[model samples]
Target: MGSLRFISSPFSATIQDLGREALAYYAIPASGALDKKSLQLANKILGNPLHAPCIEFSFTPGKIEFESATTICLTGADMQFKVNDKIIKLNSIVGIKSGDILSGSWPKLNARCYLAVKAKLDLPNIYASYSSYPNAKIGYNSGANLKKGDQIHWKEIPLNVSLENIKVDDKPFCESIKIKKAPEYHLYSKDITDQLIANEFSIDSNSNRMGARLLEKIIGDKFPELKASVPVLPGFIQLTPSGTLIVILQDGHTTGGYPRIAYIPENELSAFNQNAPRKKFKFKLV
Candidate 1:
């Protein structure tokens, strides 16, 4: 196996894959890449399996040095990626040789980016996945974000794969997200429901993978007490006591007492993944 050493790890770098599937039965959420479509495209370009491990960078970028030549792709946030001082374009595959350096910054348009290599990432799989779940302390490098000086191991490619041979589709990148009404939707009045769809809500500054808060016209006394620690999943829209709406994501808590008004359709998860603070989101009932 060849080693890819991280000379500089971005602020929130982590080894992310398609995450464990069966663990969800135990209430362990699948905390993989928030922008899964991007991750899949990157893998597709490299001819890697859809669930192959990749690097997820947040906020800042990092530097990686390959021990041998390898084919790689970058997707998701268009982070300012560069190889040895030369900027590389996004959504395409590139070949990196031994001694070459790969570095990048967070995308100006999105929050995170996905980096995929040709061969499988040589890491231990827990519960049938290489994805990292920080909350549960499971999978890859102590189940935490990648750090500076970490050496990423991977199976070496037999031959250098050229970017020209890689074919990446743009469909998932442009698809619209769909959301379904949750069980708690009946708790709100029709007026409140109409307001939710008609009005535009801004992404609050205080948001992350766990959930995103939306700033909207307040709705007081709406389901003041729905006290049950029921199951919650990605895209669950729960109302806070103060009437604020919180859209839960991949890393959201397993259960909560708040009333879940709706669930973002699986397709729309990517959009919410990159939603920037102050950006407006409009809901539509299907």
Candidate 2:
């Protein structure tokens, strides 16, 4: 098997696929790429399956080196990476040579980025997924984030694959998120529901794969008391006891005690992940 060595890891990086499908019964999160559309684009450029594993990085930029020649592409949240010390464009396929290094800083527009290679990262499988779920102790390295001196294993590929160069559209996703009322939507008072639709909410720094707390606080006595735990989907908006709005994300727990007031589709989660802290967006009920 061939491999690539990590010269220095990003602030937070890991190999992720589409995540586990049927393991939620065991409380395992479907911990896939935060930005699936971008991940798919990277894989498409390399002719790999849409769900093929790729590197997802957030915040700080870092570096990685190739011990073998291969084709690679960086999609989502422009990384502004450089191969061989020469700057290369994001969302474009590029070639790498043995001993070549790629490094860069974070993008100005988004937070999460995807790096797809021609070959898949050799990772352990959990319920038929390669996604890393550190909370559940599943997938690559017991669901650990990429760290310095890590070796990513891959199989050798033909020389022609590395010679291909292609460009792709890197347009942004919709700024307005479409959501529907959830099972507990009625728990919110008229004022609370009206505020959610009329006001623009920003992502807080506390946001992560598990969930995010909105900057807007909805406080009032009409709020429903805490309820029994129930299964909820990723992107479900739940109000906490503190009157804070918590929007669930890719790695959210299967069951939560909070009332789910709205549905933020899974497909739209990629768009949400691109939003930097304090980035504002409005929610429209469908």
Candidate 3:
């Protein structure tokens, strides 16, 4: 098996695989790639299993040099990507030979991006996952983001490699995420609930994997002083005491103290995870 040596990994970059599902019981959020659908599709395009290891870049661009011939794919943000100074398109697979230089630019549209080599990477596994949970220091390179001069390993490509192009629809990225009324939904007035569904909200700048604060429409509420810590999930819609709304995301805490007004539909949680600050998002109740 040949390894993909990281000549340089940009700040906030991390090599991750699909996360450990069992760890969720311990309240460890499934910390992996934010744009999972895009990651899986990129792997599928190169005949790799859907959950194969890939590089997840956050906000910054990355650069690497391949030591062996390999197939690769990039998805999610339309960050300016180049191989040996030649620009490449996003959401498509490409082939690279040894000694080739791959580089990417800060995203122009989205925040995160996935880079999958033809084979899986070798890293320490915790509970059967190579995903990194930096807070807990579990799995991969001290469970922290990737840095310069780190070495990564990948499985060898099978000789019977078959090539096929997989087309991905834009629906997943553009569709509105749906939500279901949570137990606390009734606490707010009908008008407030209506505003939540009808108004377009912007992603707050103070956002990260832990959660996202929404610049939502001001909905006058009767209980402005409400503050009760409660259990929360990836899509929980929590309301702060000051009437600000927050949509919990993938790396969000297992429990929260705010009043969870509604829960974003499970299927759409991924949509919210990848949205950059200032991007407009609307919701629909299922």
Q: Return the top candidate by TM-score.
A: 2
Candidate 2 ranges beyond 4 A from true positions: 159-169
Q: Candidate 3 residues 180-268, lDDT tens each? A: 99878887888888888888887887776778888764568464344555678778888776778888776678877778789977666
All models: lDDT? Answer: 0.76, 0.81, 0.75
Question: Where does model 3 exceed 4 Å of error?
Answer: 5-11, 159-165, 221-228
Q: 1-286 in candidate 1: lDDT tens per residue?
A: 7778888867677778876675556888888888888888788777777888888887676788887778788887777889898899888778787888988765555677888988867887878878788787877767777877888778865544455865655333322335678998888888777777877777787776678888775575545567668888888988877888888878778788888888898777877676556656677778
- Report the C-alpha displacement of residue 11, candidate 2, in angstroms: 1.5
Name the 10 consecutive residues with the lowest summed lDDT in model 1.
Answer: 169-178
Task: Summarize candidate 2's per-residue lDDT along 28-75 as a digit string, tens digits.
Answer: 788898888888888877778789999899865588888888888888
TM-score-superior candidate, 2 or 3: 2
> What is residue 109's positional error in candidate 1, in angstroms?
1.5
Stretches of candidate 1 off by over 4 Å are: 159-177, 215-217
Q: Over all chains combined, what TM-score does candidate 2 have?
A: 0.92
Number of clashing pairs, model 2? 0
RMSD of 3: 2.4
